[model samples]
Target: MNHRNPILFEVEKTLYPTVYTLWVYPDLLPAFSTWPPVLQKLAGGADLMLPGVAVPPSGLPGVERGALCAVTLLGNRAPVAVGVATMSTEEMLAAGMKGKGFAVLHTYLDHLWEYGDKSYPPTLAPLVPDPAGKESAGHEEEQEGKEPVTSSSPDPVKHVAISDLSLKETDSCAELMGKEELHESRAAEPAEDASPEEQQEAEDTRTPQEQMDALFNQCFFHALKCKVKKSELPLLTSTFLRSHMFSCCPAGQQLDIKKSSYKKFSKFLQCMQQQKILQVKELNKGVESIVEVDWKHPDIKAFAVPEGFSSASAAQDSKSEDREQVYHAPEIIPLYGVSTKMVPLFQESGHRKGSVLSSSEVRNIIINYVKANELVDETNKNFVKVNPILCDCLLDKSEQDEISHLKWDELLSRCLERLQPLHQVTFFGQEPVVRKGNIEPIDITLAQRSSNKKVTIIKNLELYGLDPQCVANILQQKVQASATISPTPGAKDRVQVQIQGNQIHHLAKMLLEEYQLPRKYIQGLEKAPKLGRKK
Candidate 1:
């Protein structure tokens, strides 16, 4: 808790045995320079706006959304506030640096700082970006390599004291500092002095997919080194991806398995296991778990945390970490498309053939059309008089009884039947996938093999966004039976999982209870062996 000029402190929680914010050095986190006014606003509980951020000649540090960051006033290296980034570096540029940027958590004049000697932040002149701004990329790289030493040197930072300056002089000095910082931020790109071949060699030679794969491996190793504990072995792979690896990913980068050469995350883990970095085992059919991590592996020991990627203070707040992690099953919502016969019926509602609408939306349109046409039966109230649109869509050709009316429930059912059935599947943190035709429910069937051995065959899990292999792993582990997944007959792209013995009950329970899927969306539950009437 040494709070002298450099302000050394540690943030911890009684609930957490270990401190969540681990900064071996005070300047480890990325720092953004701002004006004294912005610091005042931040100390008064205002978020740091992008417009208020004073960028140095080197430009803003690369940081991802949720990364911990610090804020300092112009011409001063001493940070006056600490916060998390509200958006990534690229996002700020994309937005033209207008909206909110950093979410301030602590400030110099706040209660936390009050606990110390209440010392005012010492003035240490900020690094002056080269005025000529003609430094080559190689020189810039070299300077960056020396950034750690320069940043730490500011501690007990030797600089002229500003106490003697009058109010007008101080303001003038701040203005000059602001101009220098802006010039540095807008400095021109360095010239390339290398030959074409040399330039090519200097640039990353890997393909986009290869780079992403390497990033995944880097984040995985980093997570194993700094985040995962030996006691947390047998960690669920899905949890590892969503919680640990994602956090370790560097700023301005994303961790999407689909973008990697190894499309499946499981395959990536398997590759790591092959390389002896970690050991992955299927504790259940379709589900893989990391049972062991090679902490002392040469690669792990040699790994270095990438610059500006501080997950410890940046990933999330302490309260967020304390919350329990929960899995969100994919959401499947039914939608309807206007059919040719119903095109005229829904024309007034601006719905054309092939336009999709939710059930409630369709019902509202239908009700509005019916009421406007005064189609509801005057006497019964439950039946609706058939109009030309309804007659065209609801009646069959063979029903020649000259029926002019239908029950309310019957009319709604006929309306839905006449329209095209569609469904949208949405996974967490992903775009919704809209598909034509009815959603195929997960199918489970019991079949007899050549030796009269009963087995369970499951299909169409992909329709609900479930990975077939992962499901197979879970089922295999649950029943302690051999489970295999292969391409479905005549379908090259789709696959089915087959497990030894009739384990339909387990499969149904997983879908119905754990996944919270609607029973109507699950097919062949009747094939499950009856509890009382044993097979």
Candidate 2:
């Protein structure tokens, strides 16, 4: 085996190093360090852009185009992100350090990072030039004898950047400190005293953007650090903003995105994204969701409030709720009506007969029955041999039409016939899930991202008994594109796999030819539709 780097580390049959970060050997790969924002963006599955990169006074870190390199954050030597250079270091400088620099594959805090040793790279003084790289877009100032910093204000804790100031925060701070004097003033501000009315008036002078930013910051902090449950991650973007985010906002401040410079709701989210506070994913076409929040953000730690603050707010909320309700609504009760009854074709250890199950439940039980009894045909993975249980559950009443060997999809649909009655389980806000004994089809959508780039997202594969990790590994090798496996939006138990660019046609072929999956189970193929014959 040619171990010329890009090593394939496997566990059992699974290729655990499915991402580029894992492919590159840590010791052999050349490294560079930049600001946290750059590393954060890389970590969030973004390609590194030129402006975001920092260069030592000595010059760009030498690397060839397509060469794998390790990226570390300033103030820390740990290589938190790994990327393949899109342009050579010389070409990068020749191009005036513009356009794409590195295509990031994997980074710290990503799924692959968590899968590994979680080892921290030692302080990388190796890449450190005779001096050091310029830091944070000229935001940091180095002292004569002090260690170089990513940021270096006297009170680093309170010194928010001028650019970071919204209309509300900046205008208020300006008006309070004398509006005209703000730009003229140096880093050191002239201390001044103001009456209560003056302070309130100054606060009122903040722009709507400022107010929204403050509100959004507070809401985001609360939602991540307090309100959200550990179980509710990769939360749907809409639900978080609409439900949890608004509730966490300071009392009396309506969660309205229309009031700010970011008029569209997604625009407001983009602003938060620009700040590197959270990671958003376009899991489906026209649907953007907050996939991850940076709970370990310095801001979260710096702005930590007393625990009593939440308790006090909770008390006030309870009192307000008690006073606000004129009449209580009826409690939601699980109302079960006659629906569908199901039976397994095979009576395995846990597969019992004469039990009433919803369509989903029955589907689950039948799948278990098929697997437990080892009914699947060994020669071809897609076909399952009919046993007495499968025959009873799937066979037609007429013996002549009895099919002894059944495809997995056919077997599943046939089993649904024996499920005599189906029941509906109504959720709080969703359509009642009917035990229809219908197999939930897989969803493949072309999702659009920034720069009009498109990604092909295949979801709900878990329903077909496909292992998500295995599927991701196969796609990675087959397509030669970046593939990320994540939890499907709104469904935690199911997983979705994504590939860069439009892989619809390729995916369809892969599913049909490679995996032998039934075409009837896939949806959204029409969006990509087959192309006509070439002239």
Candidate 3:
């Protein structure tokens, strides 16, 4: 068959009814890189021209005939002029389209020819002489007087005098014709310099729905080039289908048929499963495993497993058992010493033994006797002790005579005079001091000395009218003498009493009560004696 007439012979067998319509925006030009090499080459070489035709501007000097131009057919209308450029042969060469333009043109023409009766405007029939008429002898008389037509100067070919196309038509032929007309009108408009903002507005006029259609066309074209069949096209474009099958399905649900990689789709399904929006089951199918799932019929309770297998329940039971096992035994207490064993003694009235004793006991037993016997000095009010038991047993006949007429102070002074000579007497490795009518217990050796005989006599001064001060003073003197005379050499042997001045006053008050002395004498005794009596 002649290559020029190839469409006439080949179109019936090869042509498909469905045609892909693609639109290119300025910003999306880069995405052309993603197109198959054939498409990229076709798009790069194609110029902006009238739809369904490849014609360059007549006025341009260097323009060549049959050079490629992209004539945009807008919604089956006449083609629109957008922008024009020279073809990209390098891109075409890379795509193996170097000498293959004829092949592509033939393919395109064949599609038009087969579908043309159904697609072309009724008005266009008048522009082309009937092929049957040309074959008849009537066509020879029409050319007999005509000058030979040159390719450059043939009478300007009459444009098909068809009515402009409209998008409102339901028929496919009418839609295609409408788009062709629309494209031509757009191309004929004057190219005034438009502001960027105006250009942007023009660009933005195409809606998202329009863009989706363009993308679908691009995809369809690619699939067609791969030789996909008419029935398979629906499945491939099912993502744009309005059916429940695509809408209700989970994000990553892989249909029975596979094409592109489904890794992203698988991840989407897993996410849906986690959210309880889908349910999946893994089925072992030979070496490969297949997952079967329902996305719309999600099980809400799938995540709520029973308590026995749950970690939370086990932790709670363990805590409860630990609390139950904690021991709370009673405390043990032990009894110790006199605090637990002794019951207290009580008086006949039920008051305790020592509790009932008062100041009356001391006044009656000691104070009244001293007062009645005039043992304490009345003029000086100086207190003295006169225990009758000690006086009768220890005072001897001669010493008694000397002290008998003296007042308690005078008697104490005389006792001190007599006892001074016995201060050197030693007993139990200690020397004992002596005062006239006062004595303290010493060892047997000191008790045997005649000079020390005065020791027991002074001890008996507790029986006479002797104050505890006089007794203490006399005792301290004796202890000092013993410390001096004894063979023990350490300073620890010295006797000292740490009494504060206020405590000495308190002692005087107590002595006043014991001896029946008046407060005046006790007051006079406040000052301690500065010097000891001369030896």
Q: How are the candidates ranked when ordered by lDDT, highest leading?
A: 1, 2, 3
Residue-wise C-alpha lDDT for candidate 3, range 58-116, written one tens digit per residue: 21112223342222221111111122223343434343322222112211122333332
Candidate 1, overall lDDT?
A: 0.62
lDDT of 3: 0.26
Alpha carbon lDDT of each predicted model: 0.62, 0.51, 0.26
The ten-residue window of minimal lDDT in model 1 covers 13-22
Q: Write the per-residue lDDT of candidate 1 for residues 1-535, one digit (tens) a residue.
A: 2221112222221010000111222354677866443454555555677766755435689999988777766544556666778899999878766667776656666555454334344332212223243234224323322322223454412321222223332223223332332223213111112233332232334467756866787788667766666755676676577556765776556788999888998888887787677898877555667899887664565444454445453323333212112224678898999988889889998979899999899889989999999998989999899887677777887653588888888888888988999999776555677899888878888888999999899988766655565567667767899987665776434668899987878888788877777898888888887787433
Model number with the top TM-score: 1
**Residue 418 lDDT in model 1?**
86
Off by over 4 Å in 2: 1-140, 143-193, 305-309, 312-535
Global fold similarity of model 2 (TM-score): 0.28
**Residue-level lDDT tens digits of model 2 in 292-336:** 777665444334322224453343334322311211111122212
Among all candidates shown, the one with the greatest lDDT: 1
Name the lDDT value of residue 170 in candidate 2. 21
lDDT for predicted candidate 2 compared with the true structure: 0.51
